[model samples]
Target chain A: MNDSLRVVLAMIELELRRLRNDRTEVFTRAVQPVLWLVVFGTVFSQLHAIPTSGIPYVDYITPGVMLQSVLFVAVLYGLTLVWERDTGILKKLLVAPAPRYATVIGRSMSSGVRAIIQVVIIIPVALLLGVSFIPNPAYFVAALAILFVISGGFAALSIIVASLLKTRERFMGIGQALILPLFFASNALYPIASMPRAIQIVAVFNPLTYAVDAVRGLMITGNLALLPLDVAVIALFDILMFAVASLSFRKIIE
Target chain B: MTFAIDARGLEKVYKGNVAALAGVDLDVKAGDIFALLGPNGAGKTTLMRILTTQFKPTSGEAHIFDLDVVRDGAEVRKVIGYVPQETSVWSDINGYENLLIYAKIYGLPSRSRKDVIHDMLESMGLRAPAEHLVKTYSGGMVRKLEIACAMLIRPKILFLDEPTLGLDPAARIAVWEKLVSFKEEFGTTVFFSTHYMDEANAYSDEVAIINTGRMVTSGTADELKHSLRGELIKFSLSDHRVDEHTLGRIRGLEPVKSVVVTDSTLNVTVEDAETALPCVMDALRSEGIPVERITTTKPTLEDVFLWYAGTTRAPGAASSIGRVEGKAGGTRRE
Candidate 1:
């Protein structure tokens, strides 16, 4: 194979190996979303006064919860960069023959895979919880595409933050603070129309809102029509974040 | 023949206005063990970072085998292996697994990776610990593992930054032996940075002494010692008062370069000690100034360090020699 392809494959292998060794992290990543789906979905389902998009509360929240899980887990990707810097592993890689951009892409891809795995685990649990949806093959593909884009965009944002922050503690602290605000402001917990005017405005601009709306539309109605716009927004965000991330990463490595 | 590494006017300043490296010029010929000796914060790590392409120079240029570190870093990285100061291998993974991951990252041939990994493990004396988690290994073992990872690719030029720090005396010797064998067998150009004067003198074919972000001097160990230009005479005085009249008489002796008086001793820096000692002793005896003990020793690398950098001990360590003039000229003993 060519050099770039080899590097990409190697990076994937490395990530898989690391994931296997940290089985606890993988298990937690899978379990956390299910807990939110079961506990929050049931408790909030009883509150019948809350409005939804012609669906039950559990069903509406399932997609949002899944998207939230993927977004949160993806932050670990950037946090790992901070750990790598402290350990001098990043410096070691910077000296290697691989193109710097390829390294960034490889890491983003790995984070995307982890995000997909979490989504897969959540889907069956969502079904078991009576959160039913139409299974359109086209919608399935679109949902997967949305997951990839959102995960990649979040991972890129993580890398950019990790590169700018000097310490791992600072990175984690700032990452956690940013995550809560982004989730609350997005339509992760409720529909944009039902939210207050100020929060609705915030949700319109939140990238995760696009991801959740797109996935919710697919899982509930199997509608692929609006999937295009959702996918486009997520893709645009990913490209913008990746560009800024790669530039900042290059500066850090340099 | 091309040099393994060449750098000109390489400089780096951190975000806080700390000048880590300031206009360093260096050259290392192929197939030689070159050591850069400096105290901590003397910009050794910064220079290494730039040379490895991990940190960009504020100005100037560096080339590894004709590949520009800035412009052709990707290509430059393929040929060089860097063992960073920190032990960075994944602590949760086994030694063999760590090597496997690194080898794969370097795109080593899949078919040969197993054999290569086994060889590196055995060669680094890590065969028994090959299957053990790195977290279980001792500090010295972890360091050995780092070296093994760097060796997996058989890099043409190897950079080791403070490889033996924190190692016991026996482990330090073992590491040195391994480095020597690696260099001799593979003809790899080895560049290492160290703060230990004795370690540098013992292991380096050529040593570069750096202080305050600049190269103070560079030469073979023997050449540095020879450049000190006089025998060092240290005498233990029975009384602090070896009268000024007697000190004047000792200074008047033939071949005596200079005399320095301290609280409890007299030290003479001389051109020819055999010719000056008897006359100096005769003057002391005539004055009834008792000398409890006397000794003469040849100049050492530490003396050369003291002569050039103006301090007796390494820069970050403790020592009593006040500042030595930072002059760029060679001075001969009288």
Candidate 2:
């Protein structure tokens, strides 16, 4: 493999080892999404307070919860960059013979892999909660692809923030501030139709909106008509985020 | 002769007009253990960063093995392994995983990556704790793992920034032993920046002292100490009667190189303290000066540092020699 590919894989290996060594984060992050699915999904499903396009509220929210978990996990991924820079690990990686952009791409891609662990956990919980996913395996695969793409984009966005903040404490504040707004402003918690007009405008532009739309369509509504547009938008988002992140990655040292 | 590392007029000025490095010119011969010594923020780290391809110089140029650091950064990086002052290894990962990551980055052949990493672990004495998380390892072990990772590919040059800081005496010794063996076994040129005077005095074949973003002096430790010449005859007077007349009389002595008075103590640099001591004593006694105590000692690296770098103070602190009162009071500006 080429150097960039090797670097990307090496970074993924780093995340995998950490996860394998300590599975606590995977388990801990699952708690929020599970709570959302069981408590919020059950309550909202009974009241029928939000429009679900004639589907069970829990099923409509299942894909949204999956995206939420992925978004939450991936958006904070840049914190690791700040932590690494602080600890001097980032300098070690940067000083290597590998391409600089490869480091950014590699670390951001690993965040997607990490967020996948959340999806793996949430699917069974949603299944045990009687939230019916479309039986087609192809749709599930496509949904995972969309989730991974969006997760990579969000992680790259986090890396950009990391380069600017340059401190874990500041990155933490900004990351927490960012994750909630990105989640709430998107259609992850409720339909954009039920959201206010301002939020509707924001949800239209939010990358997470298109991700949730694609995931919700594939896993719940069984709709592929809008899949092409959703994929295009998130792909563009990923490319844009990666470009900005690659440029900002080295600035953490400065 | 072609140097392992060569630079001419390197300058790094950070934002807001902060000049971290100001026209630093350095050359380290291949296979030499060179130590860059300076007080805090003396541009030692900045120069290392530029040479290691971590930062670009604001002006001037540097080359590692003839590859320009900026133009051929990837090529430069391939031939140099850098261990920065910070804890460079991932604390959450095991030692083996840490080395494996570096091995991959260095593009070691996949088939031999494991063996190379295992051998490095054995050499660094980290094999026993290779499976444990780096956080579980002692400070010295983590530092050793970092060095092992850097040596995985055995690059032509290894750059370290404070290779051992905050490490205990034994740990510091352990780190240096590994570095020395690496240098001997691979013939890799080792360039490191450190604040430990003894480490620089004992380990480095050549030492360069920098002060306030400028190179003060560079030579072998013995050469630097010898550059001070002769010996220092320090005597304190009970009466504290040392004035210009007394200083002028000592300066008039044929063997005395320079005279400096600090508080009640007078430090006289002489060509030969043994021959100059009695003359100095007769001069003092004839002048009705009562001596408190007298001692003679050879010039050390610390004296050389003080002679060149002035007092080790915060950057931009007053550079004046207010404590020492004599003609040779302040540090010499090279």
Candidate 3:
């Protein structure tokens, strides 16, 4: 492997080793999205609030909740940078031979892996909720690819924010401030068409909207037409976020 | 070849207008243990950070083996290792894994990486707990492991901000021993910062005392102590307050070389303590400054720091020193 690739993988290895010891984080974080699925899907399915067009309401919300899981895991991964800074781990990595950009990408890549794990956990929950999985293998593969991009984009965004804040209290404070705004601004809980005109306009720009649209289009309804646009936007988001994150990451060492 | 570390007019001022390093010109020779000794917030860390390439100086220049730290930091870092003042480690990871990540960063070949890590663990005397999490290790063990991480690349120069901070006396000695052995084995030029006068005196080949971002004095420990000639007489005040009136009385005593006060403890440098003690006691008794006890001891690094830190302060540092209570401000002591 090349130097940067090996460096990124070494960083990923660090994350994997840490995760190996954190079994509770796996079981609990995975369970969180499922519980949200169970409560909202079960309670809202029969209420007729969502017009699912004869598709089960449980099916309509499952993909949205899975995307939520992706966003939750990816965005919160920034906290580790703050913790690393506090514990002097970031200082160690700063002087390392690898480029700072590699360090940022390595952390975001691990977040992508964690998102994949959550997708697996959410699958069993979808079954319990009477939701149908994607029937076509090609489209399912496409959905997973989209999921990875979504995870990568959000993870990169987390790093950008982490580099700016540089402290847990501030990073988490901003994270908390932005999390609900980003979630509610999107069509995670409802369709953008059903949301008000202003909200719909805002949702047009939220990455979570594209993430949910892509994942839900392929997984819930097998509608792959918008999948291409969704993937394009998320891929663009990942590239843009990674570039901006790399720029900001240099400031950390400064 | 240039000096192992050479810095000229090195200055760093933080964003808040705080000057962490004012103007420091330093030279550390190859294969020597050099200590930057100073009180807390006296720019020791700032100077170390600049030299280690962790931060850029606001002004002036520094070079490690003649590579400009700011412009060629990547090249400099390749040949240098830094152990920061704080615990610069991943505590949740085991000692072996910690070394592995560092080995990879240093681009150690996969074939020799594990062997190098094992050798380092063994050399640091941490092989027994190599697999155990660093969080479970004692303060000394953690420090030693960090030093091993720094040494992973066989750096020609090792920069330690405070290698034995927060360690017990025994643990401090352990870290010192590991450093000593590592130096002997690798001929690495070790540069560490500390407020502990004894740590510098005992371990380093040369010492530099920084006060308020300025290099006040730099020399061998023996030369520094011997700079201030005469015996040191320590007077323990029966009452914990030495009013200015009493201070003047003691300062007026004939044969008193100099008087330095730290709280109620009075250190009087004189040609002879025994001869001066009785005369000083007579003066103090008249002034109602009762003497609890008195003793004479050889001059030490503490006296050396007190001499330099007290004498070399700029106008601004004088007030800061007063708030620091007329002594070295750091909590760590020799």
> Among these predicted structures, which one has the highest TM-score?
2
Q: Counting only residues 3 or more apart in sequence or on different chains, how many pairs clash (N, Cα, C under 3 Å) in candidate 2? A: 0
TM-score (0 to 1) for chain A, all models?
A: 0.90, 0.96, 0.92
Pairs with backbone N, CA or C atoms under 3 Å apart (clashes), candidate 2: none
TM-score result, candidate 1: 0.85
Weakest 10 consecutive residues of candidate 2 chain B by summed lDDT: B314-323
lDDT tens digits, residue span B1-334, model 2: 7799899999999999999988988999999999998888889888988898987999999999999999999899889988999998887889999998888877899999989998998989988999998889988998899999888878899999999999999999999998888789889899999878899999999999888988878899988765655577889888576879988998899988777777788888776778999999999998888999998887678766766676543221112321232113334424
The DockQ assigned to candidate 2 is: 0.72
Q: What is the C-alpha RMSD of each candidate to the true structure, in Å?
A: 4.3, 4.2, 7.0
After best superposition, candidate 1 residue A203: deviation in angstroms?
3.3
Q: After best superposition, candidate 1 residue B140: deviation in angstroms?
A: 1.8
Give the TM-score of each candidate.
0.85, 0.89, 0.83
lDDT of 1 by residue, B110-188 (tens): 8999999999989999999888888899888888888888888888899999988888888888888888898899988
Residues A88-134, candidate 2, lDDT per residue (tens digit)? 77888888889898888888888988888999999998888888888
The lDDT for every candidate, in the order shown, is 0.79, 0.85, 0.80
Kindly report which residue stretches of model 3 are placed more than 4 angstroms away from their true locations once superposed: A135-142, A250-254, B230-296, B310-334
Residue A48 displacement (Å), model 2: 1.2
